[model samples]
Target chain A: MKIKTFLAFVGPSVLAMVGLIAVPLIGVVYLSFHSSYVKTEIVEVKSSVPLFGGLTKTTVEKVPQPVLDENGEPVKVWEYVGGRNFDTVADPGGLVAAVSKDRSTTEDGQPTSFRQRMDGLYRDVTDIDFWGALEFTLLYAFITTPCILVLGFLLAVLVNSVVQWIRGPLIFATLLPFIITPVVGSLSIYWLFLDNALVASLLEQFGAGKIYFLKDAISIRTLIVLYGVWHVTPFAFVILYAGLQTVPQDALQAAMVDGATYWQRIRYIIIPHLRALFSFIILIHLMDAYRIFEPVLVFGSNLFANSLQYLTYYILNFEDNYYKAAASAILTVIGICILLLPVLRRTYREQKGVA
Target chain B: MAMTRDEKFWEGMRWAGFGATFLFMAFPIFWMILTSFKVARDAYSTKVFFSPTLNNFISIFQDPYNFGPLLFNSVVVSFSTVAVAIPAATCAAYAFSRYQFKGKNALMVSVLSSQFVPPVVVVLPFFILFKNLHLLDTRLALVILNLSFVLPFAVWMIKGFIDALPPDIESAAVVDGCNRFQVLRHITLPLIMPGVVTSAVFGFIQSWNEFLFALILTNQKAVTLTVGLMGLHTDKGILWEHMAAASMLIMIPIFAISFTIREYFISGLTMGAVK
Candidate 1:
């Protein structure tokens, strides 16, 4: 292909990507350091009140009102506030103060030891909203990654061992959870655990007391992680199952002849065979679990637990401040890049080799 | 081969695991389908038996919970996004596969890296831009915003398919007095038609299932089905059966499309990573 031809074919997509993605990324970074506000001024007005007779009384009060242009839209002012939005969103000073205060003394003002100081550091970091959200998001990603991989591998093995006729239905059953819309999937699970719903009622029927699963931080976080694993494990299963079809049957036969146990074969042959797919799943899962937004909304877990994406969203939508939201969003992006650095480097090397 | 006692034990365990896995994976969906048909009173219970009714579905489509417009918006937005993304992606994928152009690797790497950017980063600026342009709450806004992720995905997926092709057919067409355009149109397009369709379906699902962009960019006139789920949270409390019914509406089309393309779905998902 000529260079012109290649450019002609690729131009539109490159343009769209640059216009939509690259430009917006730069804009987000720019907005993080600046804020737009409606210009306002204090104005006083007096209104007369009629008495019973012809006399009247007047009073004046001042109020801050947005200054409008000739077009009647509010006049806007743009100002740069370096790191203020970041500070507002992260509360870093508060975090440092909390940690230092703990380092010096206990709550009752006694001197603290190293272990106690470490414990207080942990508490202080989590108490700050941004650090707490990062902790939960990372924990969710790490916990769900292994669970999904193991369960998914086991599922692949079971499906591979099953009769051919049942495999289709089994795949269908597994794909339902994976393919269902995330919000709907999370909502379905959330409905079952509601106080009067099926799961809660079943627990009570089995002699447990009434439990408010959604009310507590621990249970809600657990449910969120469970939802993550349940929703994503099928994806891993499908990919690994595809990998399984390529595993050499002769190697398995040799293992069987050598009196290898099932677990031993899985540990030695199947795992090493599917190692690439494992990393693929982990890479995708980490990227996704960091942006765990819909479940946080559907499960109403924001009051108890917030993912980094959810915090950005809460600031963007509920607080309706783009600057702070952009600051939070930039931090979230940095976190993902850090989390994915190793996998991404490995992938880049492999792609370069292939090229 | 005949099964020994140990083999029999392992087979039994496999069956048990299969059963457990099936129940865990399918039960929530089954419960969803079941509740969508149940009366409001029975929906909150744990009973396996209930007098089911279609009234919940009927009610959701009427009055304040008018899902008809939402359904329309979702279909329009998703289809428009795929229609726009697939062609652009196919062209780019072909270029990347067939040509060794300058800066190709840099461009490809940038495309791939953009996929991992947290969506909120892009959405924040788009939100502000769309607000300034008064494009909020329009299906067009959604279609354009969705391309940020969908185009990259479609490019990588379709490129995977193109790379797998041998290129012999295109060379033959070129030797037989075909220009590059004619060769691509006559030969390569037909060869990669299945890939194109697969990418289309995958892109459609991504667009349909998208939540965050639609959530922030839309309010009233252009709510997609996924965002429309929020409507079920009424002040009277979430009407469970009604919500179930609405969820079915959101899920049924995706379920249908996925089942038909089950074979391609896995390949499309792993195409970027594997290749």
Candidate 2:
């Protein structure tokens, strides 16, 4: 009887969890292996080049003709077999006929392996643009995390210590960045940083050159980091500020009575008390910062010196290579899991102690 | 006894630090709002102070992509999510708070860990799933997704608040022939109203500001303000004055809702952290 009740209660939560979360993640992993291609209706074999600002067309006699059915319609001309390039076209019969026969061997006449043949049929996943994107994403996350944390902590402390009348407005104001959609926020930042815009103009007036905020590589990266900090700091501030409120006043007073300076009080009384909160915020921020997309997309990915997150978007949207994007996402997820395991374990222990 | 020079100096330093921190935190937002009122040429120019105009505001309203629908979508998603999530979460929170069930700790831990799952990772799958289910490009899709995200948070946060409430009140009600349902509806619900409101506000704001999931899941029919704002950039090359206007319009309601229930948001954060 007890077993029945236990199963009944656990059943829905488990079902919802699997249905909502697990299935989709598994589906993404599955789709990575499959290849999608654009099929052309007509198989026209022609080559063209321009000569002195004029058009030229050439029809090559060596081009392999398409197989036809009884209806005189062309059949499948290309099969994406999987690998480095999608140049190896196979005929319907799977025979090493005209196209393969001629282009199959080098001048030395060494026979190519079936693996090599197949490898030539598809674009290599590793050689795709996803790797550069992955690198940029990691760097972006690493740089933005500490800036948001320290700044947010300082802001949280400031808000918490303010007078009652001003505190409400101040807290709300600090949260404004967070409340605005990242798309809008990124656009706002882009405008503010434009070469002849408010920020650049002010810089130029102070003997600074026309600061191309989003044009060059280093400047773009700096702007992205700044944009990330601007967008996410409010979240960290809100979480830490709440943590501050829960800190036992008695402990703070005792520390003060012990002749501890403000810094000493913060170091001893505050930081230790907020350790769990800090970890929690950091973990959340890490997960968020790693998956950054909208901002990069809005800012224009081409402008960045190195854009990790934008690269992911480009791989997914532009290249349409789900395999590489999926692989990259999986790698990101693994990195996050590895970093978070220790934090999760600690949080688990703390929860257990409290319970 | 008069204060020493050293004490005065320390006090002055603290004040200076406080002032600097406040300015650092508040300036960007103030500037954003200030820029929203600036004309296109002025907004683009390097000048800090200029005559503010209502042209951006006038154009935003007159523009085909009216902010109204997006704002409406945000409200619908936020409120609907809270309405659905709170009741569902209340039930779950009650079961966890009242019952000494097996795997309770594990269940609680799972709920807490769910918060860490990046929305990006789930978005693609959810997009495909929603497409299959015919829920893609609908407000219902966002509401349901928001519920899933908000429900766990609601459950965990409300559980903390409920657990803090003395069990003696419920025990007495039970002794007086009140069934579990009656006790919860009449007794438990009233006592935890503030906590419920807090959870609702958090859920609402979270749903309101949610971008990645909304961006991926919905297109024209159910696009929220966040996604719509993204469209502005993608469609129009980054028009600073227009974007600033759109941003201010979107931020107004979020500011109002968050500040109105400011205490609850603070308490919700602490409850989430401490737990």
Report DockQ per prediction, comma-separated: 0.77, 0.41
Top TM-score prediction, candidate number: 1
Residues B36-147, candidate 2: write the lDDT tens digits.
Answer: 8888767666556799898887776666767777778888988898887787677767767777756678778888777665565566566656778999889988886776
Give the per-residue lDDT of model 2 (tens digit) for A1-355.
Answer: 1345434534554556566566656765565444554433445666766666585767744444556768786663333334322111111222323224443564589877767655553223212344345455677788888888898888888777768798777777677777665676776676677768777888888998777776666677788788888888888888888788888999989988988998998998899988888888777777777667776776665544334445544555566555555544555566678767887888778777777
Candidate 1 lDDT by residue in tens digits, B24-86 = 999998999999999977888887788888898888889989999999999999999999999
lDDT for each residue of candidate 1 in A1-355, tens digit (9 for 90 to 100): 8889888989999999999888998999999999988999999988899998899999998989999999999999999999999999889898778766637687788988988888878877888889888988998999999999999988988899878998877887797888899999999889888887889888898999898899888999999998999999999998888889888889999999999998899889988988878888888899999999988998887767789999999988889899999999999998999999998877777677778
lDDT of 2 at A144: 85
Name the runs in model 1 displaced over 4 angstroms: A40-73, A103-123, A254-260
Candidate 2 stretches with Cα past 4 Å from truth are A1-14, A33-128, A156-166, A245-259, A302-312, A321-324, B1-9, B46-51, B132-135, B234-236
Candidate 2 backbone overlaps, count: 3
Residue pairs in collision within model 2:
A83-A122, A136-A308, A137-A308
Best by DockQ: 1
Task: Work out the iRMS of candidate 2.
Answer: 3.1
Q: Measured with DockQ on alpha carbons, how good is candidate 2?
A: 0.41
